[model samples]
Target chain A: MNRIFKQDVDNILKDMYVTSEMKSKIKEKAYSQNNKRIISFSKVAVCVAAIFAFSACVIGATSIFEKVKEKLGNTYETGILKAIPPKENTIYNNISIDTAAAMTDGNSAVAYIVIDDKETVKRIDDTAKISKLNINLVEGNNSMGYTVESVGYDKNKDTVIMKISIDGKNLENKEISLEATDIMSGLESKSYDTKGYKISDIINENATFIEADKGAYNTEEGTIEEYKMLKPDEINIPINNDKTIYISNCAIKDGKLYVQYKYKAEIPNQGSLYFRFNSGLDDYYNMPNVVRNFSVSEKGDICTDDIESKNGWCYIENIFYIDNISQSKDEFLNTTIFTEYDYYKNVVRGNWNISFKVEKLKDVFEGKCNIDINGVNITRYSLSPIGITLRGYSENENVSMYDIDPVVIINGKKIHIYGTSSSEWILDEYKNMEENIVFKYSFSNVTNISNAEKIILGDKEIIVEKN
Target chain B: MGVNIVQQEYENYEIHLDELMDKYGNSILRLCYMYLNDYNLAEDAVQDTFINVYRSMHTFRNECNEKTWITKIAINVCKSYMRKSWFKRIFTTDTLKEEGYNYNFNTNIDRENIVGEIMKLPQKYKEVILLYYYYELKIPEISQVLGIPSGTASIRLKRGRERLKETLEDWYYE
Candidate 1:
């Protein structure tokens, strides 16, 4: 009887097999889940390791003070920065959000927040990040530019630490509220290689081409970001795929190779695609610069409630000014198209909201200096134990704030400062800076700025004056 | 540098997943089909099983056989799917017959009757009987998969066999 039953069950299931499409879906999901944290791994290897170490410390943390200390780094150990006690134990949707620590020099403020998923099986995956986030003052005109950085994730504890840095303007002695509606995770970067298919041959065989409406380049002028409308019967080649973003078109015209890609925007799963063509002699770093542009919507159509709406199709094209495409046809064919797909595999929806009062620290140096170097003027500056912000601008259209790498001479030692953020260049209609390009420089280390004698801006040194 | 390590680990994980699916995909599908009594739900169960297996690969310490470990995961996934309130509301024997008929099973009438009667058994007995007969798992392995003691698995298997015999008395007694 068992034999008969076994045979019958086997007969019914022998036809059942996992399809290739299903396997692909499973593999895609797994890949996205595992590699989400590794997106910034290449750019910041040491930072990633530090985050992991901090997360390890967070797992064993019993007191909120210890958690605050860990997020603030060893700066708290040196007694340079004071930790602001946080309002903890806010739970929603099986997730806990706690403001771990906060400190301000009255000019700038930084807050460390931790999100802990209290579930047996963790939904806060490696790529989990906040979306639809809003931060504002409770009872004042809140005009704060803040940067939220996800420090890292602890797999064992199912926790994520985020640091929010805000420009302190009327922030002291005020209630700051933060709310995030959703947490998005599982970002995947996929590459599609069109190997063995020569671009020239594909164009010749199909014999189909349309003039590109956007992303046309002028090699002589060296202006890559110029927009031009499509002429009649434009040779715009379109490529199709079964994914979110793909290389929609490719063609060679006027000593330039144009690769147009269509991406779906204003959707839950957003993606952007780019193409890189190399000579195969060196890595892609040596490749020529890619000029790019996009088509301005004629109808000004916006995305409807329907996710599959065609109104979401946005076209972005890249133009490579290859020296000679006829000679480098092989190199063009070997180019790889990469699609950075940002998707939320799991979205924990809830009001992750918290409000806390800002604590102002007394140790801060705020000043204004009249210093000029390389035709660029430095007007004002601020130095806190945590960071430094310098505001300046250059009328020499070529000199951006990016060119100014300031060095702080503290206690007879010159310490180079890295830029954390900068304001946009007040550009004219010609895209040339009309006014100053203000910049803010934030150092990674906790510096004893009180003992600093002078700051070397560009090539000129200015004495640090108290305001 | 860190990217290369992660890329290597991801490649290895993908290969391991492919091997697991190749080895046990069809078998788990069959097991889920027999447990859920619906082919579509069984297919979904198979996908969920492999996804869970891939996610929890790090937690698997070779205490028992790899097959036994995977079977336990698949069984747990099937049980979880069965617990959903929607599963009870939408699932019906008529839908099962209609879906099963789509499989085009061309077996002997008596063997088909035996398969139907075994599926009709209670959830407790049906699971062990299918694990024992269709999956050819030992009582100890069935105990691990079902999270039951060996004695209970044996009792359920025996009683499941008796019930199937009573339902198809002519075929079993013959």
Candidate 2:
């Protein structure tokens, strides 16, 4: 029974999960009166046209871009492209690379390629994902790594707008060929977005690792890095009634400063530090701040047996790479560091002269939770100050939809996971392959884990029997 | 577990929220998505609608149908969302030059899907078709939801059907 609307779509609409947590959120927000709203439609009449131009592009990242979707009001591509005004309008065979010079950002590239606009717009409503054009950005001699980021169309001009991102650091290129061999389409990807997941989906096999640059982590020019271990000593810390970082262990080695300290607080704290590396430079010049490459192991080992660049900068185990960090004494003393732990708005940051060098690194605390999820032996392999790690074995190459719930239930309250490290792959279809998958997830305000009751994975509950 | 008095009062709101979500959540989401053409945006507008529903709960005087009341709220919320100028600025023509950051605007159910075909229709035709067919409202109810005369609703329905026939003639004849 196909009416003007299709049955399958109605089914899809009906099947959109209305979660219990979402209901709770609605209840909370509904009771609260704060509702700061969006920009109105009339003032931005141009956006309505962009909406038409971007109708095809709307299929991607719908979940992420829902907040501003109203701007996507009624319109077509012609009004959108004309509003932006394209640069050099070049045409290829039947496929015209309409405009290339009009846009330039260091990280990405966009090309206005002219094709049958009507066919493309029609095809957009007909297909799931846009077909990627067989176009590549080549340097003078070599081809650069890039992928089709987005493809939109302009109905008025009959152009396929292709936006691509260049791989690696450098994005500076002047002239590049728009090689349109065939209309490449149909590449589907499974997006592992946490926002799309429930709080309990912390352990979902869809819980893939987020790969970001480990930051400007390079080999320091010396044989041994300025490794220094501070002894357990009481240095004068400007004590706050609410927060105190009592250093229990401190070390500077392998191009990273490690501080392990017990944080006692009357109130919960979520904070980040902004620091500069004292690399014996003449003055404080801004080096490419590569703080992300710095990893942390506040309690247990955030770094697993997998030799990788995570858990603060270097793993406590094998912190070796490119040339040695045998630093001169000048490079060592100039390394006098400063870090601050500021609580929520009321308290200004205490830029404690941590080089006052009395606080210690918190003791390495480890926790393990063994639970059976849907008969699969999944393990909360380890819990540290930083986060928890999940492990499971599968005889079949992959697991089922069972891996999505990543929440640890403590006293009936859901504790969601942040992100993780380890060799955990997506659950693809395979037959006789076997692998031990590990997922290390981080969370907020989890100071201790002695009270965790169970890990909820869908309907299957794994009682966390701590061993 | 001993529930506190304040928590018990909060539970009433929670129960209502769940009931409202279960009853009309999907339909509102579908309607919003149809109007906005973006999945995430529709979800947000629906969320905003529920918030308003709760805010105006005491004001719901039982005059209009609750579903119609909710749908009207959703439509207004969506229209309010469409007004912002940022969308054009973000995805400007220059956006064609950059790579990596991209959002697909396609519906999960394409043209073969009824909602998909309805989306393909002109904006003027969209509201009437959604209310008349999808929401299953009578012409008068549609007129009330749209704040138009029943005659206008009927005319829009007639014109909407005529346009649908021109596009979906193959299906209509079959």
DockQ of each: 0.09, 0.07
Chain A vs. native, model 2, TM-score: 0.24
DockQ of 2: 0.07
lDDT of each residue in B1-174, candidate 2, tens digit only: 122211234436556666778787877877877876655456567778888877666656556677777777777667545433233223222543232122223323455645667777654467778877777778877766665557767876877788677666555533
The most accurate candidate by DockQ is 1
lDDT against true structure, model 2: 0.40
lDDT of 1: 0.57
lDDT of 1 by residue, A312-394 (tens): 55554455554422235555566443232333445677777787777765556767777765456667777776666655667
lDDT of 1 by residue, B86-166 (tens): 343235323422111121111211334655666566677778887888778899888767655577678778887787776
TM agreement with the true structure for every prediction: 0.44, 0.37
Where does candidate 2 stray beyond 4 Å? A1-9, A33-413, A416-467, B1-16, B87-107, B149-152, B166-174
On a 0 to 100 scale, what is the lDDT of residue A106 in model 2?
27
How high is the lDDT of residue A202 in model 2?
14
Off by over 4 Å in 1: A1-59, A77-82, A141-143, A190-344, A366-370, A374-381, A390-401, A409-415, A421-439, A445-454, A459-467, B1-174
